[model samples]
Target: MKREKVKHMSVKGGASLFALRIFVTCLAAAAWWECLFSVFPGMVVSRSWLYGAGLVLAVIIGGAVSCPRRKVAVPAVILAAALLCWRFFYVIQGAAAHLVNAYLAVHQERGFEVRFWEEGSLSAGTLAVGTAVLVCVPLLTILLLVIRWGRGKLVAVLILLLPVLAAILEGAFPSAWATWMLIVTGGCYLTAAGAGGRDMAGPAGAAWAGTAIAAVTLLVLGGVSVLAGRAADVIRLEEDGFYSQTRQAIQTGVVDNLNAVRLRMEGQDEEADDRPEEEEQLPREREEDRAEVAAKEAPSASDEQSETPGDSGAGTLPWDTEADGMTDLASVARFSPDGTAAVDVRLEEAPYGTVYYPLRWGGAYTGQSWEETSGEDGRDSLFLSWPEGLDRLEELCASWPSDTVEEAEKQIDRELTQKAVYDTEPGRTPTGEDFAEYFVFESERGFCVHFATAAVLMYRMMGYPARYVEGYAVPASAFSRQADGTYLAVADGTMGHAWCETFEDGEWTVREHTPASDGSASPGSETQTASDSALRHGQAGDQEKAGPGAMRIAGRAALLLAIVGCVIGAFFLQAAVRRKRRLRVLGGRNRTKAVEAIYGTIYDRSRTMGMKESSPLREETCRRMADMWDSIKEQEMRWLYQLVLESMFNEKRPSAREYRKAMDIYRKTGAEMYSRLRGWQRWKYKYIWCL
Candidate 1:
């Protein structure tokens, strides 16, 4: 009886430890996501909070399912960890090598630069050796470890990781391979952990208890999946995922800088109060100056003094004395769209597109309004307009001395090279030098942003209404082939290219410059098939194409589908892949510690986003809803806080319904708060939150 009691106590202790570990890891993960969401407004918009939460939950579910508590589980875990570590070592080495080589070879031609690397400073030939040793060796070692040392389902984990590693390596692209490898590794282990399995006390009771446990788990998992889907939607609705805030900050800085310069030029010393009646002040100044100069000069002195104006508004400011057409550039907008065509111009560390925020013009240029422009059918194209007054463009086009397209292209190549690339180094930073000199000095190696900005300003110098446009530059694959040789484009994620659009002839047209002139094909050039010419006309088809609004809907839908698909697919795939392998449960002196570590990690990550207690008083909720706080809404935060509190403190876990409700409110609160802040302020809030 005493022995039986001791065994019961041991089981309880193990369960308690397991629960504690899971709780701590989840808690840490929740806190991390909460801080991240609050700090990066884009993160909130992108639904990163829920995305992360879901990922952590997946890990917990995986670990719980894989509960290896027998004698052989130890070596299986160690082998898996070792294999993963070796894989990490190889991937890192490759990335580091690429970065170093790219850093060194910045000036090489695209061809000569040698994009791919195999091993340490060597060419592709050495790759085979490394691959054989690093990949094949570890894979073989893992299989051997499982077959020899592992006794149960742990053998299946090795099988799952093998094909995933192969897929990652086959990808060719370093970035793609590295990232996908990480995702695959995470998925594989989660599966081998028996993510789909149920628990039973022992072989004798396994059948009955497993059946009960399995039923409960399925219900619990299904419910979690539903709640997760809702949470993902909430996040997607809020996050912009990129530089919306940064662009706003830069634009504000530009405006403030320009305003300061204007203010300084206007000099407050010459206020209206300082000006006496012109005749009266002139005569009084003349009499006083005449008396004073009587002792020092003749008529010649008075004539000279009258010719020049002093700080008292008699003399021009140095800024005014500069040549005409030399002033700083002006802001230009879409002439057609009242304020509809604006996009965000702020700089950001992360990539955000123009859809969520509109860019604002800060300079002095103006253009034709929407009413002045006409579309193909003699109507306005949806919000499409451009800067007007293109005499400068006419002169540029006319002066090239070559009327043929080929000659024009060649001349453009030469001029742009001299104007952009000659005498420049590859990756040097730009500074406050002559604008043209700065471009050439900086070696024109910068991205489209620099090229487009410089070109726009140069156009403005020649008196043209030129504004920058930011949008997706879809690659050829986005389109479908038709009967003719032309292509029809569709919107896809790969369309994340940047280029400038100029308004001319009552339509916004693509502006071709260096890239095309240099003989590189545009994104859509090669994909055209001879019989696909009809697809070109597809551009003019009756399709009422989705605009920014439609694209947004598509993006959200894709994100949602991706979230659901990844979770479900990963779970099932993991289970199927591991079903054939025998299970190995952990034992030995250090087994408990390993389990503790793993459980601890899981708990911390899960609770990263803190839950709250009961809904709070309205007044307290109002007071707590600071703009920078991480919750969805000020008032709703009280609800979330209550839920989190209950989840942490209450002995009984809250129903899935309660969790879902809290998550929904949290997202709504964030969106509402965002709507209230200016772009700059929003960015500032994100920044502080991140910090």
Candidate 2:
């Protein structure tokens, strides 16, 4: 009964040892993948197959040396330690960077998609933390191996449980890599246990246990691989979906709101023009007339009508020319049909080249009846004010030649326009007395009109001849192909826009101040505009093609295969080395040495077959052998034991016949030992080298 229990323990120990070997090999493979990819990201993409091959080679090497031999084990451990140190200090940062980039790519916020390599995406502090975590992976792996190799099963089990504890703590700060690391660490622990090679009671039981453990591990790993493949697919779908939706929203939202504002402004302008000529008097004249009218009407009017200020009639709207001082200011301009079309014209045509688009250039802000110029250049020049807070703009353009109007315009469009587009929120109207001041300093929100008005005023203050022009500006991207093969630009009320026009060489050049959906300033030149459109279209095409998705799937598949191949290869290599060692022991230099080797092998084999405590081998060898076998085998075992004792203690060489008989006994006992094992154990013994 005691012998049977020992055999069972031996089988269980063999399983553990096999599990440990596979775990170690997988850990090594993962470490190698991280190191290679991080250190050579560009090369990794093309030479990924080479990396996989290298991983297999590393595992084989690890297994060949991780045996009971002192010479091999000592050197392997030293080399492994050195490599771990090198990776921790030098390679960890790049690995961390790679992980960070992957995480951000999958989980970016809506409407703020940014490239991983873009500036400001990764910080020094984040890299530092990531490196530390990467280093910990190898450190933990080494600790697991040491505990397993030292036969500390309890400590080894505790080490395996670390990942579980980490998982419980992961909720505080969730990270995808943390879960992956836990899985990897857990696998490593199992592999380490199996690699120890001490728990098995006999070769048959050990082989059985190792085979069972390996099969289960492979199944679990396969499941994980399938899930990983699915995850890649999901990430790809999400990225494409979000990018398309966000792009569409930006296009529709900005275009629609700008058009609505433009139509409202045009309607108000038309209403103002239809008012009576008598009502369009100068500021002082209107004030005098209003006071006179009020005096006459006050006595006859109701108390409510009289009490209300600026009430031309009982049903006047609040926004009418009564309560607010804003109506007196020119907020909208009229445009001819051709002039409106010019706003949608391609930049190469010089849309503002010859047309004299009128703008509310020169105006004075009084409490009522705001003053306006006669729409002449001289009058417009007279009303242009260089506000006190414009030293910055002046300094920015100071380096330009006095006549470098084009260059100055380009500089302003590029710098200030981009700032307003990215920094400001659209649709926020200015409310302060100084529109330019409020738009630039206090308010961060506005549409085309607000951005254009501020830009025009800023240019004027900087001594540039700039004016605000309100018209329809259609992006070339919004153009439809006509039957004649010419592009016909489309503009609705939503396409109505306000932009700045700077005078240079006797003509006003259009300068767009609005930003596009991608947060870039509207292209300033024809070439730039076309390039921007093409780039956007190309990006859309790329997303539709799903190149990233394919790459992700391929990459994950390669990683999974590499890990599995390395582990299986390691197991085979270790088995081969053990077989070679056994053969060498059996074929010694002399007869006495051969007999001594045979006795030592048989004694060890007997102890492994039964879980008996250590005792003097010379005294208990025959007794232990008798206990392990049945009565029929005991007589033959005793004769074999006597022959081994004579050859070792008497320092005598056995005869050829005696040597042959001893060899026959060893083979027969080994076969009997295997046949006695359970059916599953006998089957497993044929494959795994637990002996």
TM per prediction = 0.26, 0.28
Q: Where does candidate 1 stray beyond 4 Å? A: 1-123, 127-182, 189-449, 453-499, 502-506, 509-544, 547-691
Q: Write one digit per residue (lDDT tens) for candidate 2, span 313-348.
A: 322211112243223222321211111111111121
Candidate 1 on 475-532: residue-level lDDT in tens? 2122222223222222211122223333344443333343421111122211111111
Quote the positional error of residue 425 for candidate 2 in Å. Answer: 5.7
What's the lDDT for all of these models? 0.33, 0.43
The global Cα lDDT (0 to 1) of model 1 is 0.33
lDDT of 2 at 467: 54
Best by TM-score: 2
Please give the range of 10 consecutive residues that has the lowest summed lDDT in model 1.
333-342
